[model samples]
Target: MNQNYSKKCAPRRLMTVTALAAFLFAPASASLFAQAGAAASANSPAADSARSAARAADPLRGTPSTITSAGNEARTQQDAFERSHRLGLRFYNGGADATCEVALGRICYWNNNGDVPPPAERADARLEREALLEVLAKAQRENPKDDWVNGMRVRYAIEGGQAEVGLEAARACGGTDWWCAALQGLALHNLNRHVDASAAFGRALAAMPEAQRCAWDDLTLWLDPAMHANYKALGCSGRGAENARVFRLGQPLWMLPGNDLQNEWYSRFTMSRVHSLGRLPYDMQWGDDLLESQLRYGWPTAWSVQNGGAADPRPPQVVGHEPTPSYDFMAVPSGIGSPTQATAKDWEPTRKKARMRYSTRYAAGYGALPHQFARFLRGGDTTILAGGYRLMRDLEMGRAPYTAALTLDGFDGRAPLQVVRDSAPANSALLVPFSSTMLASVEVLAPVGKRAARVRNTVSPLPRETRLSDYLLLQRGDPSPTPTLERNATQAYGSTEIEGGTTIGIYWEMYRQASPSAPLQVSLRATRLGASFFQRLGSSIGLSKALTPVSIKYNDNGRPDGGAGRSLTLNFPSVPSGDYQLTLMVSGAGVTDSTTQVVRVNSGNK
Candidate 1:
């Protein structure tokens, strides 16, 4: 709930309280998908009218379905309509009329059906669903042009948490190809197949009318003001990262296969259009309140009566499928710098805090494994993204099937990035087309035991001519004196976190522009952060009381014409546990360059 949820809601009887909404799951339906299948034929007047309507003469489906089928088409439609009507009425258990009153942007005076009783538990819902689907399938075969029939078949399957069924229904649809594509997109989005879903949505948008496409393309419908404005100026038509960033990020908890947010957005669009034609529940205030309720927070997975007998918002709560961090939704992190740089603070916002709070963010259906990578200018204008990751979870004696994937979203248009997937290999190098300002999200996922970890961000391409590549940390125990991207992936730790008095390995490649074997002046230093006052004071002057900084300086020879670079196992057992900014600088042929990374050291006991 936002800051205005309590103040704006006037009537105590009807409150959009989280706990209340969480309890009541409203069960029933009141839409045309159940009854509005007009059973039209090619020459029928209804068919002609629907043909003229373009999108749909009337399109919708009622809640979860309790409609039945009869022997004849007309009788079946009538039976389904009557059954849904009864089911809708049963929402209040026995209400003759349910009243609606909108206030302060919420349902305020919902009191027509006096003393609203709790809705009865839904029973035989499966049987009712099968009957309704049978009728719709027959209707679909008979009148394939009716958009409602096609939409209901898919929507019902998706909402019921049956992804395969939803996909099949979407594919079997015959109305508008665009509509079918949109349906497929919805199903694919639910399954978290972002690339495929984006392709489907792209097809739908391509086939839609320009005006409709513009409406669908509007980011303002969901984004906060600041972000919306930012995206407005982005001119990013080729970026397909928006849906994954929004739907999954909006409710990342992978409890259900389908993304509730996507379906909710779809539902809102359908309701806005269909309700305008006047078939939905009347009570203008109720509609506004309900619409805003869904629009602002999210659509409810289910609704039910308040346990404490609250009268108003009557089925007094609307539970969201899952909550997104709305507090930060409206604006970017203030201290974060401009989005131009790959290393900007806003690039990977949740890293520091999340990694610190949780030992492993590999819970539920998602993960956050740590890894280090470096981009090298390979031949043929391709930048090779080389990295390795180590897993801390699912370390059983038996080797389980694992999939390590390097996914790069926003690759370009609807085409997916071509890369090989392996079963937890330590090190691999991928070649990608080079671009200076490419805002690509490169994710390295090597999940084990179904729960996996992934580290993703936009890495700026290496300069055309550079002195050295980024540091790749490795396990101090590894025997390989020279680090290669082809090492066993599970051997290196991505978390630069270490324990006090522990040694670790650092590896890097020297890109000597002059002679490959040129001798270079190399210096490595670890500066303690938040140093004690005495330590700072001691360092101000050259005195015996001053402590020697954790520093290592050496002269190193660069690699030969076709040689791999160099590495060192670093250990400072005397260095106290703290945060350190580890800097590596290399000077060769009078040109100097450097890179820095943060490494944390905890007490030995920890």
Candidate 2:
């Protein structure tokens, strides 16, 4: 239960970017969880003035807590609220004396009647929540400075899927302190304003004591023991950048939209505080099951009651607890491998599968976007990173051009080696000048829609001494009548997916070849890719030739000028349509190099 995360929330001061500050709202006075820094520490009158000024500058820093309700119902509700928490005190020992966290949501079902409600008999609980909110809204008007009144309104709004309402309530909370910052962060997160939400959450964490702050820093809550060990050994150090890299790698499907994992941290912060004193039948602490379940698999998207059909319905063993029931591909830490691994070359499909167990799964995830990338030698030292990223059809519902950013990141996923941004139609390309040969992750982000797609490919740059640059795949795209060696990274077909009747352009450089006219051996072979195990075995043993391989071999006479560029074409073969692999190899005096890639063919060939 005790963790080192119980240290300073973060070590650095927050710097709000100019552009981001432009969208922020005017600050108000702080209440329960407010602080006025050194300015408010001065003598009486000066301290009061400084506290007032500080509230105008930041939401989490200000005066002491004294939120009084005006008259009758307002005062009675306040008393009732504290009394309601009386029973909760028996379970949640966290304390109201210190800490900005308070569970504004109802966590217990006293009317369980010792049985889980059957699906047909279950009433819509949200309706009751809605009705109560109507009264709370009225009370909020009467007691504009009351923290409890406003905080409850914000909670109901967020859980009820009314993000804008939540934001309104959060902003209205009299105290511009922890309650304000945290409530606003959750609201902004639901609105997909991650930058702002992160800022707000940062402020809330700043208000917490070291112990509580550290508990919120733990990222291994969702990991199984083995994966948790592997993850913890990653040496994250709780730095902002390090945590970001970890979150990026943990995205279940990079292609899916929204920074779900990032939002999840703040989401857990709120949930932990609410369920801190959970009630339960488990032998261990109450709420431990819910905590363990959420930490490991993430919050479930939906819940359905399974009746005690065969057993006695008494004592209601069934609860409204259900993990994501959909078959999904959970995201594990990617891009950056272990502290020991580097370069994309060290990554393979097998290792990816092995690590997948640690990722938290989700339903209704985003679809994969097509992409293509190639590295070409640039000025001997620099490498030209050219890539094409496409927004899937469903996501490309508008004419507004999509922005694509291509970034070459280091082994630690730290400072990027190079980053290039460009905008185009649904299909976009980015060509960046890079100069790294170590392990790296080439990432592309198509940030659009409610949930979008992100792609990160880990790779080891080809040795600078290699005899060939990566073979670039191209196609005659829209508005381009003829395919040429010249390319528009943004317009290039990211992947070789063409009608079987069309031809795809192939480009590569024959490095260190003999003289320009010297004879060299060239071989281009097309084989079955994405075939079944038995089919692949047949090809391996010469057992089947249903789709004969496309083989081209020739001798080339060339005196190379650093073998910077060369061009060729490969047409889709006449075969049952699916996917195929094309490999090209060029051999000179004592040097040889080859590249292979899969091309999807859409036409059916008998």
TM-score (C-alpha, index-matched) for candidate 2 = 0.62
Q: How does candidate 1 score on lDDT?
A: 0.47
Query: What lDDT tens digits, residue by residue, belong to model 1 across residues 1-606?
Result: 111111111233323444222111221222111112222233368755764474332233322232122213523543464355334332223222332332323343232212333443255544565566677667666655555666665655654557787777777766677777787776666565655766777788798777777666554545544465566665546323554455544332222234444444554454343233222222121234455544444332222322224433333322112122122121132311222233323324233111101111122233344556656565444565654545544322124444455534342454434344555454333334554434333233333433434454455667666557677666653455455654523455555666666677776666664343566788888877777877777766754222344578887754445455567778845456677788889887678889888777667431
lDDT of each: 0.47, 0.48
Question: Which candidate comes out best when scored by lDDT?
Answer: 2
Write one digit per residue (lDDT tens) for candidate 2, span 1-606: 000000000001122333221111101111111123422343368766875565444322211344333323433543343233221221111111222111111111111111222232123444554665676677667665655566666755765667898888777766536656777777777676766877878888788667766666766654324456655565535445556666655544433345656666676566434333222112112234345444433332222322123453222122222222211223344434352243333233223112111222222223345666677765666767666666556643334434445655454545555444434556645666666543323333344332334455644455677677776666542233232234545346566665676766666666664454677788888776667787767777887653445677887665333334666666555566777777888887677788877866667763
Model 1 RMSD in angstroms? 10.9
Model 1 weakest 10-residue run by lDDT: 352-361
